[model samples]
Target: MKIIDAHHHTWDLSVFPYSWMNNPHPTGDISHLKNNYLIDDLLEDAKNLELIKSVHIQCQGGINSPVEETEWLQSLSDKQGFPHALVVYSDFLREGIEKEIEEHCQFKNTRGMRYLLNYINNDPINCFAPKEALLDTTFKKNYSLLEKYNLSFDMHLWWTQYSYAFDLIKSHPNILNIINHAGTPRKRDEEYLSNWRNGLKTLAQAPNTVIKISGLGMFDQQWTTDSIKPLVLDCIEIFGINRCFFSTNFPVDKKYSSYEKVWNSYFDITKDFSIDEKEKLFFKNAEKYYRI
Candidate 1:
């Protein structure tokens, strides 16, 4: 099948510092990802799949100097035919975010912005932003500016923060919003799973929001088709096939399994669905949402 691989990452440590990767998450150890992962590595890893297109979500590039990574990716895109879209990073709460957004948009493939908001107060390891940063007045003001530049929003947050994320999306119906890492469900207990499902259902109520089915391995490191079937089905059932899509979450997800294993698991879970549904989940929806 023609695939978009909606979300993945590649980085060259020698170029610009991936500032956040230096910090260790208490539960998820990504220390192994310190090596250089360029377009060549991604192509080699995905060699078995018909990977026609891919989206390069921000790889913890410097907060203030995120455009530097986009410029670097554009240089790669000029030569390599991968990462067809770029989701650069920016701290929306920071002053003068508009200038940074303008600079990022200068690149031909710049598609959107992702501000890591998966933080809880006192939890430095897992939290990327202040626990309540999503509700901050200044942050909301700066976030709204994305539409002005014709850029979309890609949000990464845990299930606990979905209410705030839901409200934010409801407030801005004009901007295209994508939820990253399957809402980043950090727990799999009965209660947590229940809450994650309800939270996903509520978030999907916002017509503008779409869910990217990636990173199951991030939380469940030893994932199997049986283990992930429910989460995958629940997201598709809630968002429907059109508003839901697949992503490799590569390099980071590579910590758990090979590229072939991750995509194979996704294909297995959806094997019974119609071909058109599979096509939308794999590529068409991403192509439309990312405008790649």
Candidate 2:
């Protein structure tokens, strides 16, 4: 089947600074990813799959202007054709959002933008964007720029924050909100799953919000298809067929499984579904949402 990888990233350490990659990732050490991962590397990673198109998500903290990544990705797309769309980064609390957002949309392939709202409530010392980012008044005002520019947002936050997330989405219904990492149900415990599913159910109530089932590998040290299958299927069950899609999360998720193994697992989980149903989950829904 044709695939539109809805979330993945390609980075060149030589071109831009990625401060997050340099340090210890919350899950563990990801210093191994500090090296470059260009289009050639991505193609190599997905050799046997019918990988047709993809969306390049913003991959680092905004040490510099967020549009810098967009400019770089635009140039890359000018040469290499794979990342048909981009979800660049933006810090909503910052001033000059109007000016910078205008610059971001100048690129033909720019689709949306993402700001990491994954905050540690208890460990406020470690929080990057501040614990109250989504709830902050200034950030809320600036987030409206997405609607002004007619751009989507790739929202990546924990389920615990969905109460505030709902308020944010309701105020900006015009902005397409794509929830990343399957609500990021990091803990496999019963209580965590309950909260994750509940948060997702609330988000699904808003027609503008959708979810991407990626990054499940990080949930377990030694993950398996059966382990993640329920989470994958749960997202679909909540969002229904049209409002959700699967993504590889690519080289970042490479720690858990290969491109083939990941896609094969998705196929294995939904083997009984109709061909058209499979098509939407795999490619059709993503193609429509990202305007591919």
Candidate 3:
């Protein structure tokens, strides 16, 4: 089938500074991904698959220069012709969001912005932001600026923070909110999985929000087809085929499985669906969502 990888990333360590790759804390041991992954590398990795277009999510390009990654990607796109959409990054709490947004929007393909809000109390190891980032008044103010630029918001919080994320979505129904990592159900315990399921359903209720099924490895590092099938199918069942899209978190997920394995697992899980449904999951939805 034709494919539009809804999310992935490309980085050149020599050109850009990705702090997370260089010095991941003891808990975030992503040293496996420290090497440069340029467009050539991604193309080589997905050589077996029909990867027509891709959306480049902001790979951790340092806190101070979020747009530098976007700038670099735009240069790549100018010559290479891929990464149809660029999801740039910006710290919402920081001053001058308007100026930052203006700077990012200068590039035509700047489709969205992601400010990692994956915070959990007492869990400094995994948390990306302050515990109260979601509830902070400044976040709401900074977040509101997206509507002005016609940019979408990429939500990356843990599933435990789903309610607050959902509430935030409800308040801004006009913005397109894309939830990453299948709500990131971080544990396999029955209670945690159940809560994660409910949280996904709650967010799916909002017509403006969509789910990008990626990063199972982040939660279940040793995931198998049988292990991730339920989570994949559940997300599709909740969001319906039209509102869900398949993505490869890539080099990061490469820590657990290859790109082909991840896509094959998705295909195996949804084998019973109609061809049209499969088409939407694999490409159509992403084409429509990102305007690719």
Candidate 4:
């Protein structure tokens, strides 16, 4: 079967500072980092893995610099085999942000916006926290602009903040809201599993919501395809294959396993699922959600 990786990332490490790369913690050691995994790099990985397409989610290095990043990716789209869709970043809290988003839409492969609410006071390195100003009326007003443009919102937030994402979606039920990284699951904490499952259930009930099967690499760097199978199956049970899709989250995930291993993990997890379900999880859901 041909696979379509719904979420992956690429970066020119020199262009921006990915501070998390330098963290001294056990999980932060990035000795495996590689250079220039651009179009050709991704294509080779995909061809090797039998993946037919991919969607590029925004890298943290270019936060709030949506235009420059989109243009760079656009250049790649023009030059080589880029992701079928691009999810770039934007500050819904900023004034005239809709205009910026409008400009982004003009790009050939641009598909949606990623808010990246990962910032915690103690963890300034991660880009998955919600901005404090997101709750402000002004910000919500700007967020409402997404309805006008018919764009989707890719949310990168911690499991604790899932409720906030739910609330935002409830307010704008007409807009498409995708929860990234299965709400960034932390399996080591057994207590968190039930809560995460419940939260995922709630998000699944929302008519306009979808979840990405990505980012397990960040939580457990040494995790293998077998190690993540149970959790992936659990996600399939709760969200259903139609509401879920697979992503590599490469380079970042490369910290844990190789691209081939990550792709094989997804393949293994869905091996028992029906062909239709596998297709939806691997490709169709992403195509419909991102309108690729």
Clashing pairs in 4: 117-128, 117-129, 117-130, 118-127, 118-128, 118-129, 119-129
Query: What are the per-model numbers of colliding residue pairs?
Result: 1, 0, 0, 7
Model 1, span 59-166: residue lDDT tens: 756535778888989889889978899999877777777887889899999999988888787878777886577888878998899889888888889888999999
Cα error, candidate 4, residue 172 (Å):
0.6
Query: What ranking emerges by lDDT with the best candidate at the front?
Result: 1, 3, 2, 4
lDDT of 2 by residue, 48-105 (tens): 8888999999885344677888888888888989799999877777876778889889
Instruction: Give all candidates' CA lDDT scores.
Output: 0.88, 0.85, 0.86, 0.75
Deviation in Å, model 2, residue 227 alpha carbon = 0.2
Model 1 misplaced regions, further than 4 Å: 62-64
Model 4, span 205-239: residue lDDT tens: 88788888888878787787777887788788888
Worst 10 residues of 1 by lDDT: 59-68
Q: Indicate whether candidate 1 or candidate 3 has the larger TM-score.
A: 1
TM-scores of the candidates in the order shown? 0.97, 0.96, 0.96, 0.89
User: Model 1 — TM-score against the truth?
Assistant: 0.97
